[model samples]
Target: ELAPRGYIAEGWLNAVRTREDAYPTGLAMPAANIAIPHTDPGFVAKPYIAVVKPAAPVTFNAMAGMGAPVPAQIVINLGIAEPGGQVEALQALMNIFMDTDAAADVLGQTTPQGMVDAIRRHF
Candidate 1:
């Protein structure tokens, strides 16, 4: 969807799917399980962050190892301009990720507006 909207490059979605196969994105937080799926910055048309919540939990291999699987309730997709931007964005994300209480509040967001509001508050 974002690809068509020019939010990301032509192969961005496929790139992320492929990269995720080799390097999983699952994060097992105390408050809620989350996944950060991102691809190379070259595939980004513009910098953006997208939040998604699945109707049912999805299992993804944990960042720790192949043997560990994390059930993700929410997924955060990041499209950063480059490596430097990726680092900066990730550092900001770490602040939210490390705090289970804050992360839970983000996960609790139901509507799109609510999610947008939550991100605004966090960032």
Candidate 2:
């Protein structure tokens, strides 16, 4: 649905899933464990970030050394067409990931709009 909505290429979702299955994007942060799933620029139609908070955490391999399995509560689907922007976005997200207080605050939001607003304020 997100891909067909013009946020990414037709096969972007499959690409992301495949990439994640192979490389894993999970990060074990001080605040909370998270996974930043993304695909190459060729699979992107426009730059967008989808914030998904599942009712239950999903296990993913950690991005760090040894690739430990981590249960992530927050999954950010990064849809960036430009490499430069992807780097910048990841850097910003890393900051939020490390901030337990900020991450908790963002997760406390009860609505989608509130989550977006929280992200904007934090970033």
Candidate 3:
């Protein structure tokens, strides 16, 4: 999430991939298309969520240890701004993604504003 991509989903995936060698974006979720690209807070400056709706799907190293070459289309770039300011919020998201129902709820949300609203509520 160093360089942000507003709506280019593929480019956004690349940005996330650059940090995390394995693309955490397109994991095998119940949903059709999805991605979760995150890295250590060191690479980020201001913490904010960047959403990218790419024109086409992009491939990423899905299984890091497995060496399986799976790819994902959509990308969610996560940057931690003021890491100390958002620990609880970030952990909430981590927990959300861990829970199938919660992840579904997050993915079900539409529009950047929707995501923003959820983030704000967490804060």
After superposing candidate 2, which stretches have Cα over 4 Å from the reference?
64-67
**Ranking according to lDDT, highest score first:** 2, 1, 3
Question: Candidate 2: which pairs clash?
Answer: none
Give the alpha carbon lDDT tens digit for every residue of 15-79 in model 2. 98888888788888889888898988889888788898889998888774456888988888888
lDDT of 1 by residue, 26-123 (tens): 87776678788899989998888988889988888887474579888888888987776766776677677678777877888889889878877886
Which 10 consecutive residues of model 1 have the lowest summed lDDT? 86-95
Off by over 4 Å in 3: 1-18, 22-25, 63-71, 81-123
TM of each candidate vs. truth: 0.88, 0.91, 0.49
* lDDT tens digits by residue: candidate 3, 6-77: 323334445555756643334544443445566556556556666554666666555344444445444656
* Candidate 2 RMSD to the real structure: 1.5
Error of 1 at 59 (Å): 1.4
User: How does model 1 fare in lDDT?
Assistant: 0.81
Arranged by TM-score, best first: 2, 1, 3
